[model samples]
Target: MISKAEAKHIWVLAEQKKGKVANVALEAIGLARKLASASSQEVWAVLLGQDVGGLAEGLIQSGADVVLVVEHPKLDTFRDDPYVDVLAHLAENHKPAVFLIGANSAGRSLAPRLATKLRAGLAADCVELSWDAGNLVAVRPMYGGNVLATVTCPEARPQMATLRPKASPRPVLDASRKGRVEKVDLGGLQIRDRVKLLESVETGGGEVKLEEADIIVSGGRGMGGPERFAVVKALADAFKGAMGASRAAVDAGWVPYAHQVGQTGKTVSPKVYIACGISGAIQHLAGMRSSEIIVAINKNPDAPIFKVATFGIAGDLFEVVPLLTEAVKKEMS
Candidate 1:
C-alpha cells in the first residue's frame, strides 16, 4: 500500500525494433496502467530510438499517460552502450516509483545494468507484479517450476521488474487519456559497441512474431523428423499464424531456436495454441499455459499436454494434421 505522498509515476522502458514498437512494450504499458491505478500515479513510457516520437501516439492509445521520447541518431540501432546510458540517465532524473521492462533479450541485457547503476534490487522474468499494502511485489517461478517466489523491494526507492512478454493481457485503447511528452537530450553518450545491422532476414515473411500471434501451431517429438515439419508449417499457414516447436523438437534439430517455446525459450500467450504430438512437460506448459485456448493433439491419450488443454484429440498426428489442415483450408477458401 503505497502512500499517496510517497508514490511517484510508473515508468516502462519501451523497446523499438526496426523502427516499430515492440509488442512487449505494449504489454509492459498495460501492466503499468494497473500498477499506476493501484498507486494513484501516472504511467510514463520511456521510448528510445531514432524518430521515436512518431510512436508516442500509439503508446498513448495503448494506455500510457505520458511518453518520454529520447530520439538520437546514435540510438537508431539497438546497441548496448547508448541504450544503457540513456536508461540510467532516465532512472536518475525522473525518479519513478517502479520501472517495468519486458524480459526479452534487450531488456534482460539492460535491466540488470540499469539496476546496478541505480543501486536497486532487480527482479527478472517475473510472471506477475503487484503492489501489496504499499510495497512492490514481484512473483516469479523458481526451482524449475516447482515453487514460486514473491519478492518485495522495500528499501529500493524505484523498484524494478522485468515481465515476460506474453504474461499479461493486451491493453485496451483509451483515446480520451492524455499526458505530456518530455524530450530528453542524451548529452554525451558515445556508441562504444560497433554492432551494425547490415541486413535483416525476415522468416516466413515476418507476418507475425510467435509471441504476438493470435494463433500458433506447435510441433513436438511426435512430429517424427525434421522433414515432417512441413505438415506443421502447412497448418500454421492455413490459419495465417506462426509455427512454434517444443524444446524436444528444437533440440533434435527439427526446428529453429527462434520458433521454440518452453522454459528455455519464448513464452507466448496466443488466443489459440495448437499442440501437435507434444507431451507437455511442466517446463513446456510454463511457456504457454496462459494461452486463451489450448488444443492438444497426441497419440497418447494420457499425455500431460491434455491436462491443461481446452480441447484434446487422441490420435496419430500424421493422420490428424493433414485432414485438419485441409478442413481449415476449405473453411478459409
Candidate 2:
C-alpha cells in the first residue's frame, strides 16, 4: 500500500469535446479548488485531446493551479482503451491525493477502469465531497435518492470519486488568475486502440444539455402520446430551456431516450422543473427532486409528484399547458 505522504495534489480530469469544456468538468474543478484550499494542496486539471493545448488557459482561470495537457492522435476523439491507458499512466506517475471525475457518460465508463488500474477505491455518483483528516468523504445517494450514504477510502493512496453533474457550483472565471501549463508527450506510449470510430452521429440534434439548463420542461406517460410532447417542447422553447421526459414516455416510444429524466436516465438539478402529465414515480423523482423549484401539472391531485412540487396544478395538461404557454409568451412580449 502506498503511504499518504507519497500522494500530493488533487487531480481533476477535465473532460472536453470538440474544443469545448464540459460544465461538469468545471464544476469538478470548483469542488477541487474548495478541497485544495482546505488541505493546502494544488489543484491539477488533466486535459487529454489532440491540439487541445489552447484550452489550458481557460482551465487555469477556472481555478486550476496546474494544467497537464496530453495530446495524441488517438485521443482526438473519445475511445475507452486509449483514454484509460493515458489516464492510468498519469495517475501512476503523479500519485495525487484525490482524483475527481465528472459522473457523465464518458466519465462513468472511464473511472472504474482507471481506478482498477491504479488499485484505488472509487466512490461513484457522489452528490457531495469533502476532506476528512486526509481522507476523502464522498456523500452518494442511496436507496433511489432517498438516503445519502457517506463513503471513504481510508487505506487507498489516491481517493477517487465521481461528482454528479450539476451537483456543485460552477467556478467563476477570472482571466487574471495565472497557473502553470505543462505538455505531456505520448513518447513510447503504446496505447491500446481497440475501438475504431468509423463515423460519428448527432442523434440528439445538438440539443442543450439537460444538466446545464436553468429551466426544464418534462413530460411523462400522461402526455398521452408522442404528439402531445409538442406541448412540452412549446413550454421549454418559450423559456428557452431544455425538454425532458420520464422513463415511461421513453419506454412507450413517445420520445427519444435522450430526453429521459429519472434514476434510469439523467439526473437534473435545474432552477425550475415543470412536470406535465407526470405521475412522479420514486424513480423519476430520484433524478430531478433537486431542482430549485418544481411545478407539477396533472389531473390526479393525489399524484406522488405533488408531494414534492413547489406548486401543484390539478388539471388537464392539454388545456392548461396551452394556456400557460400563451400567458408566458404574452408576458414576455
Model 1 residue runs over 4 Å out of place are 1-7, 189-200, 330-333
lDDT of 2 by residue, 55-81 (tens): 999999999999999999999888889
lDDT by residue for model 1 (103-180), tens: 888888888988887777788888889977766899987755567899878877578898977778778888887877
Give all TM-scores, in the order shown.
0.89, 0.96
Cα displacement (angstroms), candidate 1, residue 126, comes to 1.9
Q: What is the C-alpha lDDT of each candidate?
A: 0.85, 0.92
For candidate 2, what is the total of clashing residue pairs?
A: 0
For model 2, the stretches where C-alpha displacement exceeds 4 angstroms are 330-333
Against the hidden true structure, what lDDT does model 1 obtain? 0.85
Reference-based TM-score, model 2: 0.96
**Each model's total of backbone clashes:** 3, 0
